[model samples]
Target chain A: DVKVTQSSRYLVKRTGEKVFLECVQDMDHENMFWYRQDPGLGLRLIYFSYDVKMKEKGDIPEGYSVSREKKERFSLILESASTNQTSMYLCASSFASGSTDTQYFGPGTRLTVL
Target chain B: AQTVTQSQPEMSVQEAETVTLSCTYDTSENNYYLFWYKQPPSRQMILVIRQEAYKQQNATENRFSVNFQKAAKSFSLKISDSQLGDTAMYFCAFMKHYITGTASKLTFGTGTRLQVTL
Candidate 1:
């Protein structure tokens, strides 16, 4: 079975603080994604990487950046945390092949910004 | 641009019963994929079922199945003999890829909250 592990299950940060969310996958998938999930908005993509050091912006990438220094790890960085950035963060990994590749998701990190 | 829609916000079903969740999507491409993902209280998203737009027959996984209507651009999930563990927030997703065979992306729906009761 494919597993995607997130570093934190829950986090709390003050406004204007820097925050990092780490994600790792054991499957060595070529594609990794970061998404923030809100109550009524569902899950919106933040950023995605197809290979190491290659990243692309998704639907809502403002105020967020991502790092993929290695194939197994992907990190989401908030330049400066704000109350609006408080939400559940999810990481997913998948094979960067045809359109049919199903993404495997990690247990999300619920971040709270105060 | 492609967009997915889940109109039902909440649904309830008694244990050992059946329930259906509706999803619709708009896309100009003829080939694409649809998926039903379940997120439990633990916040872990699980792939429940998937259907390819090119396939005419519906897709099924154990007790979970999808009713895919290509003409209407609708894909609905049906859970039979609902179990307590089936209670979760179900999201419908659409996926398309670049011609290079890389850069596959997913567009998600608003999700439907499903509750199972006795």
Candidate 2:
């Protein structure tokens, strides 16, 4: 079984603070992704990394960035945390090959910005 | 761009019964993939079932199955003998086939929240 673990399950930060959400996968998958999930809007992609040091912006990448220094770890960074950034964040990883590969997800981190 | 739609916001069913969740997607790509994901209260989202656009046969996993219609671009999930553990938010996602280097991003629908009752 594939295991994806996040650094924090819940976090609270003040406005204008910097926040980091970390994700690690044990399956050695080459593709990792960061997504923000909000009520009635579902999950929207924030950023994704295909390989080490290679990152791509997804649908909603504003005010957020990602780091993939190693294959197992992917980190999401918020330049300046705002109240609007409070939401559940999810990390997923999958094989680099075909679309049929399943993207295993980590238990999400619910961030609260006050 | 692809868009997935799940019109049902909330649904309820009794335990040991069957329930179906509807999903529709708009996309021009002929070859793509569709998925149903279940997120429990624990917040760990897991894949329920998947269907390939080119395949005529619907995909099934244990008690979970999908009704895929290519022409209408509809994909719905049917769960038989629903249990209390089946209560969760179900999301329908669409992914277009891409080249090797590009990572496929999923376009998800606003999920349907299912509640199982006695």
Candidate 3:
């Protein structure tokens, strides 16, 4: 089974505080993604890394950045958490190709910016 | 860019009954893939079913199935014998066919909140 784990299930941060959401995937997939889920807004892509040290911005990349120093680990950073940034964050990984290339998601991190 | 839309914001079904969730998308690409993903409460989101645009047959897994209509740009998910465990948020997603260099990122809908009642 593919397992994707996040660093935190829930996090609370005050405005202007820097926060990090870590994600680790057991499967050796080449692609990893970050997304935020908001009520009525659905899941919007934040950023994705195709390979270690290579990242691409998604639809909503503002106020967020990502790091992929290692293949198994991907980290999402909030330079300065704002109240509007409060939402559930999801991480996913997938093989670059093949029939089973569909992305597998983590349980998610619910971040609250106070 | 591709976009997905889930018209139903909320849906309720009685136990053992069947329910279908609607999804529509806009894409210019000829070859792509459509997926139905289930996110149960705090649980990890998972793929329920998938349909390839090139294939005419609908995809199914156990009680979960998809009705894919290429001409209409619609892909709907039907859940049979609905159980309490089936209650969750269902998202419709679209992905362009895999290219060697480009990332096959999924574009998701706003999602349908499904509730299974007795």
- Model 3 C-alpha lDDT per residue in residues A42-69, reported as the tens digit of each score: 9999999999999999999999999999
Worst lDDT 10-window in candidate 1 chain A = A94-103
Q: List the residue pairs that clash in candidate 1.
A: none
Tell me the alpha-carbon RMSD of every candidate. 1.1, 0.8, 0.8
- After superposition, the stretches of candidate 3 with alpha carbons farther than 4 Å from their true spots are none
All candidates in order of DockQ, best leading: 2, 3, 1
- lDDT for A91 in candidate 1 is 97
Superposed by TM-score, candidate 3 places the C-alpha of residue B117 at a distance from the truth, in angstroms, of: 0.7
Clashing pairs in 2: none
Supply candidate 3's per-residue lDDT for B69.
Answer: 91
lDDT (0-100) at residue B55 of candidate 1? 89
Model 2 whole-model lDDT (C-alpha atoms):
0.94
Residue-by-residue lDDT tens digits, candidate 1, B1-118:
8999999999999999999999999999898889999998886899999888888999999999999999999999999999999999999999974446356888999999999999
All candidates: TM-score of chain A: 0.97, 0.98, 0.98
